[model samples]
Target chain A: MIVVGLLALILAFDVAHAGEIVALPNEEPSLVLQEPNECLQGNSYCAVRTSERRKFKWIEKSATLTMDWQTLLLRLEPGVFRLISGNLWVSPQKGQSEILTVETEAAQFSSRYEFWIRREESQILILSVRGPVEIRLRGDSQVYVLESGFQNWISRVDRRGRAQMGIPRAIDIESHIEVWARLFPGSRTEFRAALEEWRPIWLNAVGLSSEIHQELVHHRELAMAREHRSKKAQAEARASENQRLRELFRQKVLLE
Target chain B: MTRFVLFILCLTLALIEVRSYFHNYFSQSDRLRGEVGKLKERLARETLRRDLMAHQLDDFRQVVATLLPEALKPQRSNRADDYPLRNLATIVFEQKSLNLGLERAGVLFSKAKTHFQQGEYERSNRIFSSLIQNYPDTVHLAESYFLLAEGQFQAGDFEGSVRNLDAMITLFPESSLTGYGMLRLGKIFESQDRFEDAEVVYRTISKMFKDESMLVQEAQSRLKAVEL
Candidate 1:
């Protein structure tokens, strides 16, 4: 009995120390891994690291990483990343999470979400690839949970120099899936697998799909209406400008 | 004797009429020949002029090929007096050395752009910096500065990028890339949480580039975001 207990203790200790090493699903050409120390020294092209504190800055291109049990603090440039697992804290600038705070949880949790974070020119975009994600503006009490096929654009700066949380906007299923395929590589089968494995389950999540679909349709319609209005206004302004210019030219001709 | 005399007179009249007709026809033919000769001369002159223009265009294309070889490829219109050729002529006529300098700069810029596309930011930054330092008077000065700023921004050198962008704006206000530079500056400011500065830059872009519809729209969208 004593021997069995000792063996069990050793096994538990080993399990505790052993970190998860998730497979990096990358094709041969795109998989460039920097040396461990090089990554720590602030090389942007370095692979994602967790043993030491590192800042991963992506510029122009997109990268995807599969994490184990490690937690990473990502300092992003204008780029995109598709995180497979583990936890991530993303901020545009170093030590400035106040603008945007995005935290991802593992799939085991009831509210776990798998998502893609894109740092665009003016905003930080979060797209839920598989599950829902919890997003909050720094210093704000409100936590916005975004479901799959939904996106949010967090503005880096508002009029008051503070970051603002955007409303949850629904993205089309095809676009969401396209983003997944582009970032994660491989065929549709892999994407389906990832989605199936990480799909979130909220309490009383029934009939949520139709509601989300309706919201998406409504958002699309609103966007279309705004675009139409903008085009009409622009056309009217152009016409008025042309009329003014023509009048000025006519007056000059009359004076001549 | 009377009949013979009348026939002889008639024959003489007919011969005279035929002679006048022949004379008029020969004179008309001579004028037509003269016209044909003049036309042939004019055609030769035009063909020679076209050949000279084609040769000059080929030389200008060779210079452009040093920078971007793809630009020299045949395209629609194929006008000999295209903008690049015109610019080349002006530069070459002003100073032959300047044209040579532009060619060198183009080569360097192409290499730097390739590096940038390949994700080699450090090398790209270095080459772009060298091009700016060495070829300040090159036609690509404004674009090179912008690209250098982009490389610096990607390398996490925000301050350097801002300085380069400011320099580009100040030095090349008339450049086509000025609007894009202003837009990028606003984006950087937004990234740094400088809302007022970002708004100012976006507003400036909107005001300055009223004719650039796409750029104006982008600026307007960014302005709305800043307000929100």
Candidate 2:
């Protein structure tokens, strides 16, 4: 749930930043995260907002992470990312020896392999999809190691004003098939190919058979078509914005 | 008496004819011997030319062997299945080797440098590799190796960067760029948080070069930071 505050509108500058937009049909234009500048330092904090499109992207360079939307990210340290809301599916780049760190409202999640974290209602649900993940709850020094196919939850004491924590428990990974499809959606064929890299994890754990493989392909056409439409619209919007800027400049500067 | 004189003249004439025949045969034999000697010389020259051509062919084969891998090996399909229609949108190539231009090695080197400067590290590495593979004896070989390593580092290919840096240093120890290459290697070590390894590299660079005063100063400055 993205809250399009008045501050976002006020702080959103008219500068020509690439691939950024603030829009929705029923609500006010909700573009809050000011980004692409902070990530340039290579060792400092970088902030990014998930686009209003259907692209499940692996943010490249140092801290490469895969994600599905519904996120408002603010302040990312070298290894740590603070997810305000929505689910974040992160995996360290293949062969990279570094660990990835993600912080929620209550617990800090760190892992060398693939994991997912989502904030729902008053709790933060974390699912370790691939390897072991270390979860350190806020104000508690005890680090809980959650293995693969296990899920845990923590209370958002700061945000929701509720404190709840849960032990690691086994989860049905087959149930999360739709979730992975939605997140890494390009096509079933494509998704299956991408999953080859995580062969040891997904193939054995999920047991994705031919039937599930077919179901994954259903969302391909629609998502791609939607992505094309939105991207084209974004390009047009950027062009129109540029044109408007030129017109304003001509009227204001040249006329004056 | 007259009959005896005629018999004597006939005998002399016959003897003279025999002598002429023998002289003609001897002269012909000498001419044939001279021709055989000349033929032998021509044969020797042809054999030497053939041997030289064979040597040149061997050298050419050696040159091709360095560059043939890129041309022969198919590009890895990292995202071939990711987008089914991706081939229509992008260049799809397999089975065929990329263009090899040993003659245009200089032009390719400059292009690689431009790519590196523009921060297109992957593209830069590809071009540099082509140049290195095709033109092993290229004038820009040392720099190409250095830039290739540097580009790999930028592209987060730490292992490749290390291997390339080691190769460049080993191959071109006499080149002026070796000090800089070592310095970059030190930086790569530091990037991987191998602080002790980086300190050792810096120390080696500081100690190894007498004329490379600039590199020595840089290494010394870096040493202080790494020490801290």
Candidate 3:
């Protein structure tokens, strides 16, 4: 009986020490577990209400959280989250992680966008940031991917029942990072660090720095100005003849 | 011997238990240390990235400062003041009476046309110029302007011709002469090797005055020529 009791104690100790003890990196909790409820049988999901005014971040393992209206920064382990209505910014991390699926509504349009990042060949990270966000239009069975970037209109079903996507334009990544930084007051440093790393990459992809883009834009403006000047010169010469014709019509045609 | 074997087995089990306890504790500590090392490396990378960005920003600023001033250099004015006949028209307009009758304007326009036909372009130009200034309210104003521009073209004063032709179209947009004036402008542009301008004028005439079959044909031909 004593031997069995000692074995029970050892078994309890082993169970306690089996899993890796992952302490919260921050002294302050990364996420607030508001209105925590007991998980259902055979499921490890947390049920919590979200609001637009509230900010949330993921700092640990995979778990389901429902967001009604909130901004979430996924700077932790890759996990799936059901965002009923809100924006989420996922930062790229080192090493392979699970495929993150975010069911969220687009900011500008009232359409569902399923954003997912999956590993390709265990190395290449194929991030479908904007495009490949599976969108199924109302009354259509065919699903279409949102063309990359923030779009003005949602993909809609045509008369033939095929999904039609609008032209995709490049999104302003820096502005997005800035918005993310503003939302997370506590993780401002980390967000800014991510921004610092990603900004140059984005800029290089687009061509040059913002300053250089501005210069190129200015050159375009100058070309437009030159065209305007040419047109103006042509118009000025025509003004005198117009004045003459108007006066002629008044004095000769009208008066007579 | 069996008691000794049992004691040896117990001692081995106890030793294993002690070793496992220390191993678990040290492994946890090691894992934490690994995490800390990773964080430090990330921090260092972040610092280096920031420094690189700062350098790039500086380079961009330098490039902008160097190129912006030259790019934004003030374009020279192409006003009437740059022309020799700048004040001549103004002087004539100020000196002439504003109440000339339509008959008198008609006579003046005919005289200008006569001089232009006789190849006395300078004399025709002067008459046409005075007719415009004095009879700014005449019905023959568009005709007078067209004749003056023709005289200018004959005299190799292409700029002056362009000015007058443009004025004719602007002033009398509804007049049949405007279509002809646009065609002439296109020809002038073609002669000057300004094919784009010629093409634009031709396209404008062709598209805007589709009812004028002759003008459309002429513009289409010119457009094709310029495209070539």
Candidate 4:
């Protein structure tokens, strides 16, 4: 009985640790903060500052987003993923798109299916990965449509200053994709798996190419299995935690 | 004298072994106790961290919910702190989505029924599973699940049949076909020789659905059979 209890307690601890918030490492002052709206608390903006190495798992309703990126100040507005600056992966959890508008520093990307976006200091690069992406630059009135494997660049300011009007057509994204693949291997796997699943789907109304798709699927499957196992763990942790809090409150009540 | 010395030595050795065994046991117990204490501490820290994250997530979701178009916003409970009125836009979209789902489910249900009639139980089950998973809110939900279970029972999938029947009954308790579903479930239990279970189901049907004379009569007969 003691052994069983010890094992359960250990498992509970593991569960608690999994869900526990990791203090932002002192690598740099991290800022993942939220200020609630006065009208209705927490009915507004969400700020996240993630280091390059760590992935932040966020649950929005039933959908889950694991954000892994570099030098990003991302704001998740409703039906909109607003990137203030830096790179962001805009792929939905599954190949399924909630059709969220991907907005960056100088351009807005919208797609029927999926699109990926990135922003440098002054220029925003939009990658149309799978379906047709409609890109609207900050100042441009006309919407530029880009197909898969193509990218468009828009600058906030040119040498002369002011939002630079994008006169050039979108170019091929092969070189850019290669650079990104090397930079963000994990995200690359995700994009590839999604690409593989959807590519076949795209070709034959079938969908994924990239051999990397299998790896990504495997990774996701493992995570899912772990999550499934840990769901009970989480429940146990919550129960115990709530019990402890309840006891504390009761003690205070008794004192009064 | 030699035999006495040997017995004495044997007793001392046995005593020493027992002493060591207990020493090890107590040490193990102490270690485990220490581990449990550590585990509790870790759990406390973990819960606190998780709580912080949960708060942030809730805050973020709230903002997102506010920004969502009225049509897309989730249904709200009629609570004091919540807006009770359903948005007009939601009505339109909900109708559209629900209509689409109902249409799709209707098509699948029809297909499954045809398969069931044809004795193609496997094919029917495939369609039923798809329907149950995707179109749970289908208009013929109770019938769909019940028929699925009936088909499984015919196909010798007794466990599957029981599960589906249970789900159907539980999910659609107030459904018009619930009485029939209970009758079928009771019959299944009786066939499986689970007399007690069958009797319980029949009794429940007889008492719970008194308005349905035919159903009550059938359940009472089944209950008598199980009792016998």
lDDT tens string, model 3, B1-228? 788767766865796589687876877766776687668545644653454456346435434433433333336355766453333333333423344466688788878877876779999999999989988888778778877876787788999989998898888886656776787788889899999999999999888788767678878987998998
DockQ for each model: 0.01, 0.00, 0.01, 0.00
Q: After TM-score superposition, what is the CA distance of residue A225 in candidate 1 from its true location, in Å? A: 53
- Candidate 2 docks at the CAPRI level of incorrect
**Cα interface RMSD of each candidate:** 45.1, 48.2, 21.8, 31.1
Q: Indicate the fraction of true inter-chain contacts that candidate 2 also forms.
A: 0.00
CAPRI grade, predicted model 1: incorrect
Clashes in each model (backbone N, CA, C under 3 Å)?
Answer: 0, 0, 9, 13
In candidate 4, stretches whose alpha carbon ends up further than 4 angstroms from where it belongs are A1-43, A57-66, A74-76, A157-162, A165-256, B1-228
- The regions of model 2 sitting more than 4 angstroms off are A1-42, A56-63, A158-163, A185-187, A193-256, B1-228
lDDT of 1 by residue, B175-211 (tens): 5466776777888899999999999998988888888
The lDDT, on a scale of 0 to 1, for candidate 3 is: 0.55
Greater lDDT among 1 and 3 belongs to 1
Residue-level lDDT of model 2, residues A144-212, one tens digit each, is: 888776677787432222235774555445646656777763688998886676546644444433344
Give a tens-digit lDDT track for model 4, residues A44-95: 4555544446544444432333355543333456555565544555554565
Best by DockQ: 3
Better of 1 and 4 by lDDT: 4
Cα error, candidate 3, residue A223 (Å): 61
For each candidate, what is the lDDT? 0.57, 0.65, 0.55, 0.60
DockQ of 2: 0.00
